[model samples]
Target: MAPASIPRRAALTARALAVGAVAVALAAGCVSSTESGGARLGQAQSWSSVAGGPPNSGRAHAAVSDSPGLVWSRSLGAPAIGVASSDGLGTFYQATVSERGCNLFALTADDGRKRWCLRLPTDGPRITATVDGRGSLFVPMYGGVGAVSAEGENRWFADTLGIPTTVTLLDNRHLLLISHLGIARVVNTQTGLDASSELPLAGEIPPADPGYGSPWCGSGERGCPAPGPAAVDTDSGTAYLTAWTPGAPAPELVAVRFSPGETGRLEVAWRTGLPEGRLGVPVVLSNDRGQVHVHSRDGSLHAYSTADGAPLWSTPVGYRPDTPPAVLPDGTLVSGGRTTTVWRGVDDDHSADAGPAPVVAVRPEDGRGREVWRRDDLRQLTNPAATEDGRVVVAVRSGGTDDEPGIAVHLLDGEDGGTVHEFDVPAARGPVSGLSVDDEGRIALTTAVGAVYLLG
Candidate 1:
């Protein structure tokens, strides 16, 4: 599929102010996480109930439960930086900018009620926040980590050097934080502090004249480095970070592991030089699958072993592969790229079967994913959320040929990408970024403007 060239409009009114406030809050040191224990404030619930694709794809997932109804929409004093939804906990969190600094909000998921809000002192635009299994929200600040309770109270804080990139709960008590400079830290969730040990980078640093630094170094500066996303293994308590050389011809993908013990330590586990070119985030498949699937921007898929970082196989999917491979329950890998080719097959230690296998059923020995069927009607930018029984839901933005800009929801048969239901959302103002299905089989879509709509 060709890149959808939707004209970029000015930032939404609410988002603009929200972003401005976020910058101020970050500079003032106002952001922090919660430390006090309360009623299991919010329980982590599965967003989807559908099953039987590879390992990573959720069987039962959450879609927009409410329809074209406006739960609540507020203009951030600045631009909106990030948005996240907690497990069935009637609330979703958003990071936005305000005049004072960066602000975080806990809004009622059902009616968009403003449950609680916290302000930070940063002015930077790049912000990432995540909620743990215990309903504790972790916000990575410019030089530290902030913890907040679900009820909107500051718990504890920790300081660091490099800007934090990703934060995840290693367990109920430990939080893993990754920085752009290749630094990984494990913090005690209860204390809001890091252990003495820290991981170090192994390879030689590039000459830092201009563009010779890490990708994340130049986010706001001219011609800065572009950092890749980090993935963590929840069960092993290990964190993985990937990066490329400044001027390398073929991109080099490096994987390092940080093991937390009495003395925390980071070690270079395995590194592989790719065919040359930048790579995207490497998605880790959990449940002891021992495989890391990485999709490159140029449309290539590579699989690596989680244990030793050994390259298992590499294959081309299409011109611009955006969505990560969807791991079905039976071990059959369902993945699609730009060319309308949704590849499906069993994921073994062997190389990916060369030449597109005619969309067919594949059985996995592990009883994980069984390719029951394949269809060509399903096209999407993100991974298609599956239903508990066997339905796949996708979002598509229709290019306006003359006067109409529309978005459509297509339900596909899980076995084959056959169309099951098609509904067009008229008067859609922008591109759709998220598509979710509720427990009652209602489809909810989130647009770039932060408007979420329900499709029949």
Candidate 2:
């Protein structure tokens, strides 16, 4: 099949998914050996998961780019429709949703070897894949979420809970998820089922206001944003998110306290209305320390206490960031904008809204930032993918042009924002999607078409 262009709508033709029956006995953050796989993948949490590390931090620890070589690349044979994840040790995973069906592949990151293929009862719109701390790869499908063990054994599966958001590995015992409907469910990784039929592992979102002028909380599958995906703190059993409450003037950041065990239910602990007269672009960012960060449409960043939705610091940047800032291991913020950092971009001005802007690393303390570095030539930058070893991966592309090369992936020193090296995208075009790292410090890019690139 030819590589696909950006898709219009993700349509899944699969039937009700089969969630394998796994007996549950959550004994100290471990699952029983029901899986056929001998042992888990690798202990190297190198670049596991889509966002990079366990909490999906989008940060890795390995020094991968210095020895630049296209170790290998694999063509999914179809356009990849969603973000990609890696076990980091070796196994890399992604989903291909097409007119036929949703195809999931577990490829060896070291050599692009096809280790296992897991197909689901769903096709594309947008699905996020994650690798459990223990090594199980999870894919959120239309009817249910699918889990495959490291050794290529089917572990468990469950339903199209609702408009699905990405999965978060909260802690050893529980897996957290939020549907488009704003309902939250906690899955027992060991049991693969809720504690009881009515254990109440669900939460509800605020009702939507029909009177709002703009379309509310839209995603790839359904644009209606009721309860968005959350930044969870497993220790406190708390979820921080934003929802467009009905009858309200705008969306508000909500802190929900959830019951941890099978008896989990949602409770709106507290919520703060987003400041009015901004773009209303609400994304939640969290670190292990319990601080929740969100970027407003206006040139400002807001920090809030995840405990009670208390305000922390509100620093004003000059430009509205297009995406949530990437948090480095040291807690510096990397955000995109026009002239907020020290290094001014040298790219000549054009009419594009995204011109030669600087990719800056800001110290979260005072909302002050310094130019980590900027490629004057590379205008529209992808979110910076950082590794714990002080290296950050950035994918850049020219704004508003398809004929030119799509995106160039670069490795930079997170400390000084120095360029380590750049990877070549063979036949690259269009903007790149899901620029992420795995446990091995290898960077992966899913093209607008169906190809997946693994560079280190």
What TM-score, over all chains together, does every model reach?
0.67, 0.77
lDDT of 2 by residue, 1-456 (tens): 211211323323223234232321222233434342443342225544434543334556565657555667767776564557765456777777555543777787778888877655442224456676456766665545666666556556655445445466666656665555455666776555663222112233333531122123322112234423466555676766666533456666776665665475656688787763233222445555567777665666677776677777776655665444667777766664321111112332422234444566655554333444444454444446766776667767633354554556777777777677766576766544466677556777776466788776
Whole-model Cα lDDT of every candidate shown, in order? 0.46, 0.54
| lDDT tens per residue, model 1, 152-254 | 6555556544445556666666676655544556787766667635653423343232113323232211112224335556556555545544354544445
So what's the TM-score on candidate 2? 0.77
Q: Estimate the overall C-alpha local distance difference test score of candidate 1.
A: 0.46
Best lDDT among the predictions, by candidate number: 2
Candidate 2 ranges with C-alpha deviation above 4 Å: 1-15, 19-48, 53-56, 123-126, 151-155, 195-223, 226-228, 276-288, 316-322, 336-358, 366-377, 398-402
lDDT of 2: 0.54
